[model samples]
Target: MKGISYARYGGPEVLEYGELPDPKVGPDAVLVKVRAAAVNPVDWKCREGHLDGILDAVFPVVPGWDVSGVVVQPGVSVTEFTAGDEVIGYVREDFLSRGTFAEYVAAPVRTLARKPRNLSFEEAAGLPLVGLTAYQVLVKALQVKRGETVLVHAAAGGVGSVAVQLARHFGARVIGTASEGNHDFVRGLGCEPVEYGDGLAERVRGLAPEGVDAVFDTVGGEALKISADLLAPEGRLASIADGDVVGYGGRYYWVRPDAEDLLRLTELAEEGVVSVHLSQTFPLERAADAHRLNQEGRTRGKIVVTVEWEVEPAG
Candidate 1:
């Protein structure tokens, strides 16, 4: 099968499209014929060898995590799904496994859930990593409550878009930071849009006189430190980006995937409480171009790769 693989870490140019042997399915895994795969900042970070100490990658790694596909073969122990079931999931990052960039991938059954009935493969492909990250930060770590006011940085990006919607669904009023161009877009997601950069804290203060109940920082840097000051006393703060640790009074969190959290996000999508926004799609062979676009960091939402394949009818 043709897939994107990198034998060494460097720039996006290092990624190449080529042939690789099909993955062997395990007893608790399912072999999926990938329909679409989404790009995350983590993909590039991994590609550049940024996660060296924390995540050891196998040479010639396929770099993607979120995937939407149909199950072509189920493991002997898997009873929840059969061949031809449409599913979406976050492949484990630990092994640096061959991922969704390929025409096919083997995922642990527990990592996947039935794709939302209302979504297309491109849409479902954008949800797993970003959706789960947002869900976990708001519902699990911060425990955002109804009537609370929450602040989200980089509100127009993939995870930020989902975070804004989920916070509003939980009854919390949301304030999101994006450029002026996306103000209307963020507002449409039930958030008050603020311009990000210097004086961001002042802009937020103008909106919430009493201070925000929680802060979800997706653009970690000076923004993370500034977000801490925006927090109300006893407020919650979580960062999904790297180097976000700060001595904030609120809880500090880094997003990690749990099968349970993915299940919750799946339910939210199925119920129409959350929506996935896919901004762009590229063919599997253009993985390099996909990475370059994501590195630019200006996309409105998720970027995905479509793998050509035949979909069996749902039984």
Candidate 2:
């Protein structure tokens, strides 16, 4: 099999595409033939060793988490899915080694879910990590309620875009922070768009003078601090970007893969309540380029890397 990997931590330059050994499936995992993999900021972060404090990297690590693919074989003990099932997964474990940026991956059942029937493989591939991040944060961390005012930072981003949409679905009046260029895009997601940077607080106050009922921060540091200040009395705040949020009386969330949660996201997707905007896509061999594009930090939606295989003609 072939995949993208980096033998040591560095920039995108460290990533190399080449032949790799086939993966062995575990008792609770299934071997999937990769269709598409989503490019995320974390992919590069892991490549550069930024997550070293937590996740240990096995040398020559394959770097991807979100994936949509078909099951080619199920483990001996697995019954939840069989060969030919289409699935999506956030395939991260405690360590960096096996990943979705390959021709195949052995995904644990806990991290797998049936792909949304309404989405293409490219779009479904972008959902797991970003979708779960927004879903878990809004539904569990902040508990966004209808009729409440919610503020989301980086609203046009992968996580923020889904966050704003989910908040609105829960009946919250959402205000999303994005660049001036993305205001219209943010507005289309059922959010009141506010330009970030320079008087961001004032702009938010202009929309909700008293303060918002919930703040979802996707950018860390100053953005997280501003979100902490924009909350209404007894308002909730959560940040996926900053661990320091704990110091400001907010929860710092790390997205976990749950089969149940991913299923709900698929339902929302099939029901037309949630969707991925595919900003760009690259072939698996060009995954390094995908990382470069995401590192630019201006992407409006998800970037995907696709694996294409030739099919033999029918007998």
Q: Largest lDDT belongs to which candidate?
A: 2
Model 1 per-residue lDDT tens digits across residues 235-311: 87877663544556455665665777877787888899888777889999998999999999999999999998665
Q: Give the clashing pairs for model 1.
A: none
List residue ranges in candidate 2 displaced over 4 A.
none
Question: Alpha carbon lDDT of residue 303, candidate 1?
Answer: 95
Clashes of 2: 1
1-315, model 2: which lDDT tens digit per residue? 999999999999999999988999999999999999999999999999999999999988999999999999999899999999999999999999999999999999999999999999999999999999999999999988879999999999999999988988999999999999998998999989988789999999999999999999899999988888888999999998899999999999999999999999999999999989999999999999999999999999999999999996999
Q: With candidate 2 superimposed using the best TM-score fit, by how many Å does residue 290's alpha carbon deviate from the native?
A: 0.4
